[model samples]
Target: MNTRELTYVKAFNEGMHQIMAEDPDVFLIGEDVAGYGGVFHMFDGLLTTFGDKRVKDTPIAEQAIIGLGVGAAARGLRPVCDLMFMDFIGVAMDQIFNQAAKMKYMFGGAVSVPLTITTAGGAGMSAAAQHSQSLEAWLAHIPGLKVAMPASPYDAKGLIVGAIRDDNPVIVVLNKKMLGVKGPVPEELYSIPLGVANIVCEGDDVTIVAIGRMVIEATKAAQALGEQGISAEVIDPRTVQPLDIDTIVTSAKKTNRVLIVHEAVQFGGIGAEISSQVQESAFDYLDAPVTRLAAPFAPVPYAPILENAYVPDAARIVAAARQLVERS
Candidate 1:
């Protein structure tokens, strides 16, 4: 288990480097991915290592970018397309939903769209409403797409590699704020299977299930709750579509209380689906109702003051956990 500390962006770069070196059929295409090395520099140094053939820069047309990937993937090439910002996914919805997502099913398993779509998401740098929305829920709703949201450098590298190797169309949603966050990741190539949940910490009184950037906030809340004599367990569902509900249900059965948190808006968010499944599977074991903490239904604000209040944080999570535990 050799490892080194790397930032989320660097770990992703290493994963891409390794995957491309190992598979000749794999290549990356997206705006500024080759020369500019991506807006966040996540794909930095890839063009120099793999050369222009494997690393290509495309015009700022998301629809054309995804359409090329979809077509390339259907023809037996593994194409990793970058969308820059998840907010721009709406512009290429047809290529994503109608083409890449349904190609395998439409061809009756004769064709497999081994396409990987990577994009940056989350609201922390005042990027405005259009650029900072957490839209994994929309991709997860599609039947043929697999959605992953990594919280750390380790998961970031492993999940990207896993998504590229997977035969189905997979979307890896990276957090803009977590790009510089550091964590221990294996120096060697590795892959983390989808549909698995990481238990961040072990506790008893309450179970806190978090997604993406909220996982970090949930960890902070668990520590604060610990000092106050409350035991809180934190679970990170690394992938939302193929969610690991069994882990959450098992935790609920132990703690008898559950709290789900995410950066997405509460209404029709993934938290609602997780809540429904947890209650349905572990109804009799619960001592209290399942609760969720998320952003409001309004668009993401631009003002620093409003954005700070908009996204959930450690203090908010701690307060929510305390209230859930105090319920009688």
Candidate 2:
């Protein structure tokens, strides 16, 4: 019942510590994860706590790293493979989509792959295109893969614990910019069920559904809209795969308007899917079209100024919400 403010990185580290201690079959393997404590220090103190047998550092080969996880998980071991950067997932696509994801299904449920893939994503630190990209949509599209994006310290810990315990392969995509953000988190081990939506702020005028770090921006936008007498509800879809469209549709039915936001490019993003479902389910309740505010169709810029402009902010959300609300 007690809680403390912990940064996203710290919460993530604590979750790993608790889960690894509780489950002997769980192990971590990734580049710089053991000795370096992860590039973002999300794995700090884990190596010391669990030792080299559990926390292992691997070569820079993502394919081999994922392959190792697939094999270990199929053999009854729980492996948390750190992909370092989500953008590098392309290098190990075969192991992920072909092997790890399809193994249990192809084997007729004879084998289970409790593989957890943790990676950093989203653009903010100007890591450039290669290092920063919100690719949750790609993983969510896969039939056997589960994708989760934590927007706060509490969800960071809860989702990580949940993902590690899931029997199927789950990808926990952490935003690089939110690693230092702090929020209330329980000291004890906890697991938030995936496929559930969190109603960050309640309202009746408009629904603002945001993913990952954009949830923070959407919350700010909601506050700003409140000042203008335009009540805005904010929802965070904790896990994209097995998404809780019922929560979203219910909110849309109440508000009669919906706006989805994300850091990924607008085209072919998860927002599109959410918008489609909302419109289909709540078409009669709608006063306006379901809108989406997201990054432009371009690579994440390296320059700070350009990157700042590239990523959507609270101002953009506020403006978009205002427009959607005004549309009658």
TM-score of each: 0.99, 0.99
- For candidate 1, the 10 contiguous residues with the lowest summed lDDT are 102-111
User: Could you give candidate 2's per-residue lDDT for residues 225-247 as a string of tens digits?
Assistant: 99999999999999999899999
Query: Weakest 10 consecutive residues, lDDT, candidate 2?
Result: 103-112
RMSD to the hidden true structure, all candidates: 0.7, 0.7
Model 2 residue 319 lDDT score: 99
Q: Write the residue-wise lDDT of candidate 1 on 1-328 in tens digits.
A: 8998999999999999999999999999999999999999999999999999999999889999999999999899999999999999999999999999998888888889999999999998999899999998899999899999999999999999999999989999999999999999999999999899999999999999999999999999999999999999999989997989999999999999999999999999999999999989999999889999999999999999999999999999999999989995
In candidate 1, which residue pairs clash?
none
